[model samples]
Every structure is written in C-alpha cells, then in structure tokens.
Target chain A: MMLAQDTREPFFRPEWVSRNADRIVEQLIEHAYLTSIAVGVGSLIAIPVGVYAYRHRRAYVPVTWLAGFLYTIPSLALFAFLTTYTGLTTLTAEIGLVSYTLLILIRNVVAGLEGVPRDTREAARAMGYTPRQLLWRVELPLAFPVIMAGIRVATVTIIGLVTVTSLIGKGGLGKFILQGIQRFFSTPIVVGAVLSVLLAILADVLLLGLQRALTPWARSRPRPEGAR
Target chain B: MSVVSEALAWLSDPVNWSGTAGIPNRVFEHVRISTVTVLAAAMIAVPVGLLIGHTGKGRFVVVTLSNVGRAIPSFAILGLALPVAIKLNLGLGFWPTFIALFALAIPPILTNTYVGVAGVDPDLVEAARGMGMADREILRRLEVRLAAPVIMVGLRTASVEVVATATLAALVAGGGLGRFIIDGFAVRDDARILGGAILVAALAICTELFMGGVEKLARPRTSTA
Candidate 1:
C-alpha cells in the first residue's frame, strides 16, 4: 500500500513545469481556443435574438425565460448531460459554454439598445435617416459600451468554464487539475489553477481595452454631478 | 430515446431511493451544503454591502473585489483550496467544496445589495432625516425596505450558483448528487450519468424558480422607480 507520491513532495515544482512546458502551453492554447469558439458562436446567435426581443418587447419575456433556464443548469451537469449525446469532444464543451453566454449577452444587448435615448432616435429620424440606417449609424454606436460590457463578462465566464470541460476530458488546463488530484500530486494542480486564473484576468483586461477603444464617446459622456 | 428511458428507469428504481448513497440522501446533502454556503456568504456580504451603500465609503474596494471575484473559475477555486485545506488538516470533501462555492456565492449578493441601497432615492433619505429619524433608523425602515427586491435578486443569483457548483463537490470526494455523476463516469454507466445530471438540473431550476418567486414577493407594492 505504498503511495506513489513522496510524503514531503513540494506543492510546486519548477522542474516539473519545465518538463511539461510544451504540453502546458498546448493546454493553454486549447483553453483559449475553446473559450473563443463558445463566445463567438454565442454572440452570433444572441445578437439577433436580442435585437428581436428589443424590437418586439412582448418577446422579451419568453426569450429571457428560455435563456435563464439554460443558464441555471450547472456547468458540470450540462457537460455530463451532453456526454450522453455528443460524447467526449470539443463540440460538447462548446455547446455547454455557448448556452451560458446567451443569458448574459442577450440581456446586455437588449439593455444597451434600450439605453439609446428616445430623443436621439427621434432626432435621427428627423434628419432623414431610415429605420435601418438609424439603427446602424446611431443606435448601435450608442449601445456599444453596454454591449461590450456584456462581451467582457461573457468572455471571462467562458474562459473559466473552459476549465470545467476537463472533467469531460476536453478541458484544456483542467486536465492537469484532474490528473494532479488523481495522482496526489500538487505541482500540476497549482500550475493549472494559477494559469487559468491568470488567463481569466488577462482576457478581462484585454476586453476592457477593446471596449474603451471602440467606445471613445463613452469616456467623454457627461456624468451627472456626484454620480459614482 | 432508449438511453433516456434507461436513465428514467435508473431514476425510478426503488433501490436508488434507499441507503446512505440513495438519491434522497444525496439530494439532501446537496441542498444542505448549498444552503450553508449561501447563508454564510449572505451574512458576510450583506452587512458589508449595506455599510458601503449606506455610508458611500469603500466603494472602490467592493467594485474591485466583485470584478475579480467573477473572473475566478469555480473549478480553479476548488483546485487551489485543496492544498490549503490539506495543509490545515481539514481533510477533503465538504471543506474544499464549501470553500469554493462560498467564494462563488459572495460577489453577486454583495454587488446587488450595494446597488439596491445606493439607488434608493436621496430625496427620500433627506425627508427621513428631516423628519428627525436617525441614520440607523432610516437604513432599517427606509433603505432596507426599498432595497429588498434587489437584495433578493442577489440572494437568488447566489443560491442558484451555489446549488449548481455544489455538484463539483463530487469531484473532490464530497457528498452531493454530483457523486452519482462522477461515479457514473467511473463505471462508464451512461444511465447513471444522465440520471444524475437530470436531478442536479432539476434542483438548480427549482432554486431559480423559488428565488424568483421570493424576489417578486419582496417587490414593493407601490413601485418607487
């Protein structure tokens, strides 16, 4: 009944990281790849649904209800459930991750569009802008900040969830964690956990930068006095 | 279709309803763990959020904590907590799962509480003060009542999240319906895996619906906004 791990093995091993450097990088790449696919596909689906919801008003309730229902399912359960059909593949991971982004993204999209001032829309219409032109030329730009905020949240969330996919054997850095736990080894677990957190933070900062760059007007928008 | 029927059969079996490893016990374990984690998170977050919202101090810290909090993955938290728990001789199972889900539960409650209170009309607060009410009395009678809906939204969000992530407790050798999923994976039993997933999802959805009902109940009859 000898344990494979020495009793006093250090929690972090620099040498182990050095040995597994290539695979670690590969996993990191896979993690980023999975996150991007989910968020990208999610946005594609959510934007139109959000716009429709906003335009119809009546449709918002059921749309949100459906998204909320999907969002409520825990990631582990969704991933496991998907396994019954999709098996252990990247597709299964992507489906679970994308389903999550719908609620966050759709809500944000609708909110952003709604935040466009009524006066602004009226003014655009008065200036001879068609409905389609007004939406593209004025409303979308005004809505960009709120929409970008949603994207940032969704991206960060999807990145974290990508790690959970490892439980289904598709998680990028998550595989290290699963392995580390099974073997009673601490180094890989630390590596996987730290890298994933760092990745999340990095993605957040990058998305924030993108939002700022895209919505320069948001920075100059006048805030009411004393508004935090 | 047969897979689903098989899973249904697995779920309906009376054998799955008895003993320590039974479905009922597993569900109770899940609910118990989630309940404790959410309550603990609310206790810490509500007071802090209320103070911040009421006094308008430490606003930056709360915002930053919540922003960072949302970015950390639950699994990563579980992985990181493992060593700390081991070092403290906390052993495994509940402690590690509790640590992770508790952390997951805090940000939503804290942020919602702060926003709800701060958004309370300043004129109302001024009128309360002008009527000779003390700050504590205004917070209790006016602010808390006004902010109840938002606070409940936070509670709902935290409850749903904790319940969902509580499934990961199984990954750490912790008890919960998640154990069935993990065990099903080990045995390559598709029926058990699907059945476990259905149970976990049902519980999470129920939490959401129940919380949504509570939130609606908390809404002020005369809408202030």
Candidate 2:
C-alpha cells in the first residue's frame, strides 16, 4: 500500500540529475549498446533468410509463420527460458531480443523485394545482368525504402524490449525502472521511462532520415496533386 | 536436479495447480485481462479509425498517433502508470497494468483499420455512390466487407501482443503466470522460472493459432459486386 501523506520525492530534481549525470549517461550508452547489437545481429540472421525465402515461393509462408510464432512468445518468458540454459548473462538477453526482431525484419525484407516491378526485372535481364548483379544494382536499391522502414520499426520495438532485460539483470535503463519499482521511488522510474521513450523517438527519427537519404529516387518523384 | 528435469517436476506438481496462486487461476486472470484490454481498445480505436478512414480526413493525425504510440515502450507506460495509480489510491497492480496494456493494443488496431478502410477501391465506393446507396450503407456493405481481412489481421496482432505483454502484469503485483517467473527470480529457482516461461509461451502460441483462424474466416474470397 502507498503512503497517504504523499511523501514521495519529486520525479525530476535538479540536484539528483546533477549528481547522477554520469550514471545517467552510462545507462543511456548501455541501452543504445544493447539495442544496436541485438538489431545488428537480428538483421544479419534475417536478411539472408529473407532473401532466400523471397526467392523460394514455397518456403515463404512457413518461414514467416515460424518467425511470427517466435514473435508471439512474451519477451519475459523468452528471457526466462533462455536464462535457464544460459544463466543470467548477456547471451540470454541478446537471444531473446534478436528473436523478436526476426519477424518484422523478414516480412519487411520480403515485402520490399516483392515490390520490385516485373518490368524492371525484365529490363535488367535484357541488359545481360546476372541474378547477383540485378539483386545488387537494381532490386536492392528499389527495396531500400521498404527494408529501411522495417529496420526502423524493429529498432524501436527492440529498444522497448531491452527495458525488460533489466529483469534478468542486464537491462540498461531498465535497471533504474526495476530499482524504482522495488523501492517505490518515483524519481528513477520517471527518469528511466522518459529516457527510454526519448531514445525510441530519437532512433526512429534517425532511421527516417537514413531512409530518405538512401532512397533519394523515392523523394525525387513528384506526387500527383491531391493523390494523398 | 537437472534444469529440464526440475522444470518438468515443478510443472507436474499437482499442488501448483490448485491454490490462489494456481496455474489455472493465473491463466484465467491473464486471459481475462487481455480480453478486456483488447475489447476496450477495439471499442475506442475501431470506431475512430473507421470514421477517419471512411471520411478520408485526419489520415495524418491517425498515422502520427499510431507512430507515436508504437514508439512508446510498454514498459515505460507501465512505469508511468504506476505512480498515478498509487497516488490515487487505486491500488498498484491491476489497473496500472490494464491501462498500460490497453495503450499498447490500440496502435496496431487503429493503424490497420485506417489503412484497410482507406485502401478500399475508390471505384467501388464511386459505383455505390452512383447507385444512390447511402454512405452508411456503402460503408457497411462494401467498405467493411472488403476491409474485413485487414481488420482481422489488426485484431489478431493486437490480441497476441496484449496477451503476451499481460505477463508483465505480475511484475506490478497483479495475478498471472508471470508470478512463477518473478517469484523464481526472487528466490533463484531455475525450475519455477522455466515452468512459468513454458506456460507463457504455450499460451501465446495458442492465442496466435486461435487468432489466425479468425483472420482466415474474416477474409473474403469473392467481391460483393
């Protein structure tokens, strides 16, 4: 039960922030570090699988469904399950985080590849482009926007999930949240929550910018008036 | 005991299935919370999404709101909700968890519904208008029928997400299968953690399968035209 006298400290005290700036920066860096590694490793696994699945029509549904099923498992459960085998290590957290990103990454990669027009493929072939050459020079460039969009979504989602990693004692900003909850201290909870949200939004905007830079052709095309 | 064997032993124990902290009761609480949250979210999101999509107005707002909602972490929302619950003397567990999960479920539903309705072929809508079909009638008979598959996909995604995240409710002192994992962590009991995780994973898989079936049923094979 909570105290009736409202004895809780204010969520954002200047003195606390000044004193804990180093710890705050450390947690922020740790949060970004974990998220980036998970997303990086997830994309490494997902991209080749996505490419193969896209090429093989028969394998697409089964592969995606499996990924989707994996995604359905709760993050906490996955973390706990992994901890049983891996113990309370970063490996457990990374495995759980990476699994969650696969579905989003694969689906987006496939969708991006599929969005390439038949005429474009035919034209590339007519120009004597091999499969590898076409994939590199034509298909991939066109698929950039969609693939980037997927990465953006996956990155943001993973950022959120990393907070749950604190449960396993590997959580960056999440440690503060857990600590706050255990002690009923509003300051750490508020700071952690705010920082996590800020990181998500910041990552999203950065990815959006990257998408625009990569897909310059998408922006160059003038839209028909009132089409939107 | 080996981790796997110990986990199985814990799961097989009949005593774990018949108390206030029993598996069955926890499962019930999880499902009930998820259902209520999803239903409440649908009620709020679907109608507003339909209005925006059908009228072709506020598309930017809907899209922006969905993006913002998605960007906000569920854990952060739960943390944010806790203080409010405590200050109001509304208890620390159920309501906070429920509200946070409810927030989590809304974005997918709202965005999907908006996209589905908005993506309905303009030709079909024009034809209905040409035939003097009322706007409401066109929305019901044509737009919604065609959009059924997308709406169902949204519902399926939201339901699965809510059910999975509801496990976090136990962290807030709410009742659910998460209790096992939380308690196990507190006590350094690997078997209990594994047992709880197994239950959560199983429940999530079942929810996905059930929602997948409903999504298939909602898919329309032939056009009403």
Across residues A19-41, which tens digit of lDDT does each residue of candidate 1 receive?
A: 99999999999999999999999
Fraction of real interface contacts that model 1 preserves: 0.66
Query: Predicted candidate 2: what Cα RMSD to the true structure?
Result: 3.2
What level of docking quality does candidate 2 show? medium
In model 2, what is chain B's TM-score?
Answer: 0.95
Q: Give one digit per residue, the lDDT tens place, for model 2 in B1-225.
A: 789899999999999989788899989988999999999999999988888899989899888878788777777777766776776667767888888888888889999999999999999999999999999999899988888889888988899888888888877788888889999998999999999999999998999899999888888878453
Segments in model 1 whose C-alpha atoms lie over 4 Å from true places: A1-11, A119-134, A215-228, B220-225
Specify the highest-lDDT model's number.
1
- Highest DockQ: give the candidate number: 2
Model 2 scores what on Cα lDDT? 0.87
Candidate 2 collision pairs: none
| TM-score of decoy 1 | 0.91
lDDT of 2 by residue, A185-221 (tens): 6678888888888999999899999889878879999
